[model samples]
Target: MSSRSILLTGASGFLGSVLLRRLSTLEGNSVVAAYRSGKDEGDCASGVLSLGPIDGNTDWSDAWARPVNLVIHAAARVHVMSESEGDPLAAFRKVNVDGTLNLARQAANAGVKRFIFISSIKVNGESTPLGKPYTADDTPAPLDPYGISKHEAEQGLLALAVATGMEVVIIRPVLIYGPGVKANMRSMMWWLCRGVPLPLGAIDNRRSLVAVDNLVDLILTCLEHPAAANQVFLAGDGEDVSTTGLLRRMGASLGHPARLLKVPSGLLQQVAGWAGKEAVAQRLLGTLQVDIEKNRRLLGWSPPVTLNQGLLSTARHFLESDQT
Candidate 1:
């Protein structure tokens, strides 16, 4: 692969920050890291050329004055609380759909070679019916606004690729966990660290999570690998960890024994739903697994970091951060 200038959206996000750090250390690669607001101090450390608040109207001709070889669209409005109460479709479409098209249009005009989109497994569905795991070939039947928006964006991207002849690679990754994570993941770490007794021990639901390091590795491989061009791939660690098993491993990583009360799964679900946290309960107690054999066979990619290693590193970061 030729040394190329890459434009990375969502440079301040969890996955994007890690990718920026990795990209900075590589020689002969120039990165244009875009963020919606605020400057990421880490960008300076990573030597990324930072661009802020870029929208559909923002003139990217200046940034693309030189040849841009790749564009990684990682920016999107992720899942949030109360999808029913808000117009999440508009919110997600603004950034995930319109914003993506804006960048892709400019990149295509600039003669960019590959456009790698960091999509989510939610595009498949909120939950897999019965016992089947979602595959790359599954029809998109997104349940939430965030998922719908991403699916729409995928369609737009493929359409743009067809019209402009730019290679497009869409990566739909499951729950991604790593150091410096926030939201639900951070909450899980907090509970484990405090030894909060969770009722999830009884739940036997299986979910797939990818380590940030492994996800970044796959992104880099896709950047240059010929097989990745104009393809959609589902990415995960290939191991399905049950909620009980996940908390147990997390406890080990946090230097604490698992403090769990094996409660009835049905009762817990009812209570969680009644408390208006059905989404949270479903994610924690329900099964949403993915099969990644396609990624392994097609790209010859495997997770470089194990689940234990990733969990340990994440726990340590939280531990150290809490002290400071």
Candidate 2:
């Protein structure tokens, strides 16, 4: 086996930053860390390049200079405020779809061996049922512009792969949580730290969340695994948790008791509607999970970090970061 050079975009993101650090430790591989802005302080990779903006016009020559063998595209337009947008889909397509395809095309042209795309579980619809979970083979039914763009990008990548013979691997991850996490996960941590009395104790919904370390492990597994070639995988920590269950676990990790009130899910929804938080209500009350057995069976991989361990690490980071 020859030494391979990898171009990793979004190296500054929460998951991407961790992925970059882990990839840097590979014995014989060269990892190029590309970020839109901000420096990666812990970066000890072969090269670190500043990508001004990851749009269609962005140049990949610097990243591909060393005969890049693999391209891990983790940067994407994940958040799109559709209501305030004039052309939300088009805006999303510019970065998620067009920009992604552009980068994949460049990778193919540069003789890159594999293109690994980090997508979202939104491509498999919003939520799952009580017993049923999402699978890789399920038909895509993206309900939002962000998901729609990702699904389109997946299609484009497949087409590009067929035309250029570049192996493409897509991994769709659900809510990823770990140290340096942001968005809803971060909000949850903040609320927990402050001892907010959340009324989610009665909400019995199972959601699948992946730890950053586990997700990075899966990404690394897909990089060189022959069985993962041209495959779509659902990334998860394998253990599902309910709202109250997760709160309890996270609270323990933060060394705080979970201050939760038992409120009916229906009443919560009604109150959320009155307070103009229907989306938040649905998310809090919904069950979103995926079946990762296929990823285990096919690639012989499993989440290395247990959910509680990961949560502990996340909580520690949050408390430490806040004090800094």
Candidate 3:
């Protein structure tokens, strides 16, 4: 294959950084990595372009000089529970919905061959019942502003594809964890390292998570595949783990004792609700799974790395980082 020009958004972020590194290694890819700040042209990617606050009015002529072969959109206004912004939905829609559609319009006008969008499983809702994991066929019922914007983006992109002849692929991934992971999962790692005994040993809630690398692999798989056009796929490590089981695995990787003790799930939930930590309680005691058979059947993809392998990599990074 000949060299193909690809434009990637959010190259400075968590998943974006990992995707940038992977795309840069491709033999015939002319990668144009877009970021908001912190890197000048050629600083990180050979063709790094600064995207100054994406919105409907954002210009793309300066970024894509030539028709792009592909575009991997990873940027979005991620929800921060303590966000300073007063209106969360407006904030999310400004970027995730409007800005994303703006990018799609530009890509379509520029004759981009394919556009791969990174979405979230939160679009399907917070959790699924035990033994009844969510699948792509489920109608989106987003509960949060972030998920709502992403679902809207998905709809907008699909419509844009129909109107402009641009192929679009949508990927919805659950909690993505790998080296340098942050947020709730990272907090668990921190507590484990500090020898904090968790009261979740007997908790049987199952959660599905994808390693960053695994999610990236799926993105790459969808980027060039004809079958991925106008398709929505879910991604996970294909390993369903209980809360206690996952913590134990991470503890093993960190060389620390999980120090897990049995606690009643109901009591845990009640205390957490009383303490204004209901979300945390639900995650620690709920089952959230995804059926990724579509990814396997259609894309012929499998998680290249095992869940334990991904967890160990994350643990190693935690140990090696300044946080330790």
Q: How close is candidate 3 to the true structure, as a TM-score?
A: 0.97
Best by lDDT: 3
Give per-model TM-scores: 0.94, 0.95, 0.97
Q: Give me the displacement of residue 118 in model 3, in angstroms.
A: 0.5
- Looking at model 2, which ten-residue stretch has the lowest summed lDDT? 36-45
Q: Give the clashing pairs for model 1.
A: none
Q: How many clashing pairs does model 2 include?
A: 0
Ranking by TM-score: 3, 2, 1
Candidate numbers sorted by lDDT from highest down: 3, 2, 1
Model 3 lDDT tens row, 198-301: 89999988999999999999998887887899999998999899999999999999999799989888999999999998877877899999999988898888
The parts of candidate 2 lying over 4 Å away from their true place are: 37-42, 80-84
Q: Give per-model CA RMSD.
A: 2.0, 1.7, 1.4
Question: On a 0 to 1 TM-score scale, where does candidate 2 land against the true structure?
Answer: 0.95
Q: Per-residue lDDT of 149-201 in model 2, one digit per residue for the tens?
A: 99999999999989999999999999888988887778888888889999988
